[model samples]
Target: MSSSNHGLARKLGGWQLWGIAVGLVISGEYFGWSYGWAQAGTLGFLLSSIFVAIMYTAFIFSFTELTTAIPHAGGPFAYARRAFGPVGGFIAGFATLCEFVFAPPAIALAIGAYLNVQFPELSAKWIACGAYIVFMALNIVGVSVAAAFELVVTLLAIFELLLFMGVVSPGFSWDNFTHHGWAGSDSFSLSAVGGMFAAIPFAIWFFLAIEGAAMAAEEAKDPSRTIPRAYVAGILTLVALAMGVMIMAGGAGDWSKLANINDPLPQAMKLIVGSNSGWLHMLVWLGLLGLIASFHGIIMGYSRQIFALARAGYLPPMLAVIHPRFKTPHRAIIVGGMIGIAAIFSDDLIQIAGQPLTANIVTLSVFGAIVMYIVSMLALFQLRRSEPALARPFSAPAYPLLPGLALACAVICLIAMIWYNQLLALIFAGSLAVAYAYYLLTHRQRAAAASDVLLEGNDAARLKPAVARSK
Candidate 1:
């Protein structure tokens, strides 16, 4: 099929990109909320909020340079393919798939937690299954459907947060904050930084997926301009929201109380707003809707990245195919949905097995992403020093220094993950090592094939403007 006829539509705008960022980050409950509160007390919350903000800034700056130059649909895979080669791109893309693959069950579990609050009798697995169905439907329809759904969910989440923030702020006790002060009885010293690093996965996970926002670069109008603005703005907004939520929630009650409560916001709301006003149902529904919207946003991103990887020859070609009628990557969408469904069931089995499900899975994702980020920042530096002539509308401030700090933090966080969650750390590194071995064996053939396609892509990209001008 001709490219245009394939229905691989590309039409998204700045606001929609913002929606993507909001949706991805706001889905904090799925991974961060539960894990973060448990792992880090007040200090962990503060350090993670700051660390993620800085790390995201670094990632955004590095990614903005690439998106401005390439402005393609494939996101990191495309960048890696162009900069490192087909094998590098494949690794980048596959790592992303792993993150998302693990994330679906994590989100399902989070949704299950929220649902359990309302309908105590319903199994969490069932709620996760229901959430998956709703998001899958949103994704299958089209990008526009996904975008619209995300915008609604993003707004509702923000509103729910606003309500929580408003309610908790007034009721916050300073004594609640400073009283016990810092978990495990540690004074302000170098030791505290160690705690921050250990808590980094759960804390930083909240801000991790802002990079997914760039997945919509091809769809965005004026990507070179829209991408950087949307990307930076999204990260900033998420950091602000996270800070507000953690501070308010922590202050409204003893930070220690959060460890006991499954749903901290509802409990904090109960403490501040009280239950008799009949607003409890609204809060519950609002929170539930936020989780659903967040899941919808996640599925959209994961599927798009899968489609991108397939298109770039990182996966089987069948996954790259667009629907002849719908112009959507229907195959990839279904695959992602299936993974999510499987996640729900697997989580249920874990409960039945009574095995200790270490929060290590969460740690694995954070470590893997940080490793990717480190590689990406290195790519950015290489590009700047090696390809100074490359057109860049946006550049990271302070040249090497600011981005240097960001890279340092990412590396430090990776080391901390190893220190705290060695098993997960080993698994993450080992998984990549396996992918590298596979690449080493088949890389030559893959490179030849990818090169031919990339050349065709370049020719097509050059011809596109002329073709439009002629018309």
Candidate 2:
């Protein structure tokens, strides 16, 4: 295939897609962050993890259907436009942008926190800034670099998880399974459900870039065959990793010890490997490298989203521009990097995006992305019903049923997040509304101008005389 035949670049294959998914899955280290809720009590953590897993499962299927149908350069944005029109596309794309914009800093912040444990002398901000610079350079160079980076990072992540599980041979207290102690406090009951709800957004956030694999659909060697297969494999890989980490780490340590450490993986390692082993130090750094890879995945995902939006006329057209030499979404990559840099200065740096001021900001992004998923799923049902004859290379299993479950779970998760953080939900919804309003006004003005030209009759297609007008 000619290089020009594909938008941006046609460099990604099934392995690249798989590596991106695996890299993203292992990046956030849920067990590392969610250990707080576990320390609060086992049930709280278990319930929250299950809730997130279910929601995430649905999201994967939902993405699979849409990505399979319209494997375009823009991913969700293009699907929304084709299914719901330009305004719908704008909202979905913007929500995704909201998700992506928040993500880079969150990962950077987490990486900085981990660095603090190892290098207390250096500033977290400097380390984070440096990490962003490295990842940005990798992305601008091309997907090949991004894929290679993801491959190494993901492998390290796996090694770290396995090594930790191995070192903590006997595991921790079985009491952790039934212990009802709530994290942050000791109230465990229906009230803990509120705590679980409070935890939902970030729980969902852990899986933020899973859909990013879809962004590479246009570049995949065989999108129709590759997309669905990749989606299934990616989701399975994430679930296994998350569950394995939670179970293995949860089994090996005192829940409260996990609660104390800001970055859980290092703490877990300290417990399993102890301070004496030089080999343990190498393993710990492996986890850090995984964090770095996760950052790269987020950058790649959101940059493509920005590129998609620009291509669809939702943002400045420059955002959609591709680098002639690198064959990547160069403009969007730069823009996303700038957004990450600015996020470092925001006041709500630690505050989560949703309610009680405890809402996880990264989780808020996940909530918004779920909203996009719902939109895309609905689009799938509508497209199927309205255009039944349209050629579909690969339809999801059980047609409407599988997709329906995914949509239903998405709505439930959205409601859960809204209950936990009405303000964040309102912020997301309000921002999208403003964007949609702008789209409508611009579209209407353009239409009116076109109509005026039509009403001008022969003047619309007039042949000008050689003479000048009065002006």
Candidate 3:
């Protein structure tokens, strides 16, 4: 249980895992996804959200099979590695790292925006960087404390979203929601079609990192029983919240006004409640819980991913070191925090394809999530055929059907994201290329041995140094 042995302590149960699962994604309801309104208008974005919802529903259900079977902290990386070997592991691990590491900056910015309502003089970016410091420190303190905090904040966030919806219900108008719902025309014309396609990443924001719960598998009290329950409940909760929040917000006032901003709900609510209303101020404060939940949870996610990758020798071994007193991946947590802080500052320096910086960061993170999803589905298929004897406590109900559907949706979304955000896509691709080159030049042999150790259901970092001794 001590980091002296370099292993994670098991301290989570089904409800805590459920909290992490929902907490990781609840911020999508609070903000970020509203950019879809700018891209596709209300109706078009709703359609896009439906498409993305189907994908996540199928994906989380299907993804559970691999998670329970391997139960590794690496999550998709472990699933892909077991099914496709080192090369597969590299792709999934890197993509996952990108997804987790990049997602926090967007949430951090949302946190800053929420705080700005209460204190206008503060620089949002500095508040964002400050948030990264606070939460990363919390994550490094220990997994148990972090998960408990996630559960509490997640509950508060869910309650706040429901409160927003209730307070705005009397102002909801079907005509207001339907008013110019479709982008660019009376019907789904060429421009509307393009907008819907472009909206894919924003819609994806609704359920982006729910799979990150798997990163805590090493710390789950009973992953086999808990992961499935958590994932299933989590997806259902997010879907209902996403649909309800989006519908109510669009009808609350001019949907156009809420579009193109990081803080959507408060703006939408302000239209109904007035900017100076105590209800409006209450919302601004409570909404921060959603952003904080996601920001903090994703920090936990990225650190574990970095820890897992480093453990497998895919990165510097020092990055994998666990804290002896805290038994947390302190080094990995700090490294990911440093990267997120840099990204938060970079928001003011650049614009990609004329979209807002938040939009681009969201797409960049989605690209990584989609890529990881594709590799993971392929891994699931390969594992089914090749590892028939491997213990599977929970089988994906429809087998090829469910996974195939998830794969198809992921591929389509990735294609649309690339077409719409070519500049950011190129940036993401370039970063991956650079990292892969480092992997090839410095870590191949050690990573190969580490791969074997993982496949044997052992902690790879512990055995990684035994490579020479084994030979």
Candidate 4:
């Protein structure tokens, strides 16, 4: 498709891109990562988080180079396509879809869980599904309007985290953080080590999907300059928020109580202040902003990805049609929203060895993310060798070293997650196999159709030459 036909408007700037990057991931600070504490105690989870943080820092730095160089709505998919063939592109794109699509349901469920605190009469599932409808509409309206709203909500969410830290700082104690450190053992035992590995996915939740901001590359002005700034600033912001919330919540009280809960931050607020306190109520209400920011931001990410894939002929072409009026990927957004709502309602609560279904979904999302990271990193190396002359306004510092570290860490995380959650891993692998099979079956017909069109044009040209010669 031509650039004009792509239908995405370039209205986003550096700060807006930053807002998207942070907004896409800020929910991690609010919930989900606490599940790491459940698997590994405070210290064990902390260790896992530290490792994951390094991986993200390296990955973001290298990923920025690809985003600026390619600057496509498909993000990693575009990069992988350029480096490998159509099959590589499909793998990257499908993984990205998994990461962005699965994340929203988890965030939506959290939104419902947060709202459930105020209204016990309503079901969390219903609230979550309703949130999908509302946000998907906002996204379909326009990118600028949606991004501006994302920035405002993301800022508010950031402030709330700082507020939580200040409120609980007085009650913070080292003993609480150290209590049951290393998975409740006096020292790091084999089980503690196993728990640390199991905690990898939850630690990943702390920084997952931040890369989704790169999906906005096609919509950003001066992407070469803006993308790098947004990526670096966004990762730094998440690292700080992730560490702060974890420590503050853990130190506030018995950290174990906070684990595996949907509303860990608000629950921590209750521990620091009375449940009836106005502060607790305020936190609960304001905490919804965090969920809203991530939910809305990720919805934006997934729709653009779907739009890009469809435009590139990987999926159904209908999804590529942009709203002529709104100038948005309305079809893609609605389709993705339907999938998210279905996931929420499916309520697939198959527990694998004591892990909750929510955590399993989280593991699935991380599995997708890990796949993208590994493939994208390899694509980086491949592109450097094959497309050495390609314009790279932003280059990854330290070359092979940084990208290599990122790839290594991603592989480690992938292995750890598979070993820890074999059932979830199997499900994810099966889904990928199905997606690839469909792609292979359909892509051949598309190729044949294109060949037929080319042959028809050649025939027309030959007839024109013969008619002229006879005249």
lDDT at residue 194 of model 2 (Cα atoms): 71
TM-score of each: 0.88, 0.86, 0.96, 0.94
- Could you give candidate 2's per-residue lDDT for residues 381-449 as a string of tens digits? 877876686557777677777788878877877888788667777777787778777776665332322
Q: Could you tell which candidate, 1 or 3, scores higher by TM-score? A: 3
Model 2 / residue 261 / CA error / Å: 5.4
Q: Name model 1 segments beyond 4 Å from true.
A: 1-7, 29-31, 186-191, 260-262, 275-277, 348-358, 437-471
TM-score of 4: 0.94
Question: Model 4 segments beyond 4 Å from truth?
Answer: 3-5, 348-354, 444-471
Give the runs in model 3 whose Cα sits over 4 Å from its true position. Answer: 1-3, 444-453, 456-466, 469-471
- Cα displacement (angstroms), candidate 4, residue 17, comes to 0.4
Each model's lDDT comes to 0.68, 0.68, 0.89, 0.88
Model 1 earns a TM-score of 0.88
Candidate 1 lDDT, tens digit per residue, 63-181? 67777776666666766665675566766776676666666666666678777878899988788888787777667778887887788788788888888788678889866765444
Q: Pick the candidate with the highest lDDT.
A: 3
Candidate 4 per-residue lDDT over residues 1-471, each given as its tens digit:
344545588899998999999999999999999999888999999999999999999999999999998888889988887788678889999999999999999999999899999999999999999999999999999999999999999999999999999999999998998899888765888999899999999999999999999899989999999999999999999999999999989999888899989899999888889789898888998899998999999999999999888876688878888898788999999999999888888775545667665787788899999999999999999989977887899999999999999999999999998898888888898999999888987863334211111112223354445434543
Q: Write the per-residue lDDT of candidate 3 for residues 1-471, one digit (tens) a residue.
A: 234646899899999999999999999999988899888988999999999999999999999998899888889998988788777889999999989998999999999999998999998999999999899889988899999999999999999999999999999998888788888455667788889999999999999999999999889988889999999999999999999999999999788999989899999999998989999999999999999999999999999999888877788878888998999999999999999889889876886778777888888899999999999999999988987887888899898899999999999999998888888889999999998898888664443433344443434556556665654
Each prediction's RMSD over C-alphas, in Å, is 4.8, 6.3, 2.3, 5.0
In angstroms, how far off is 454's CA in candidate 1?
6.6
Arranged by TM-score with the best first, the candidates are: 3, 4, 1, 2
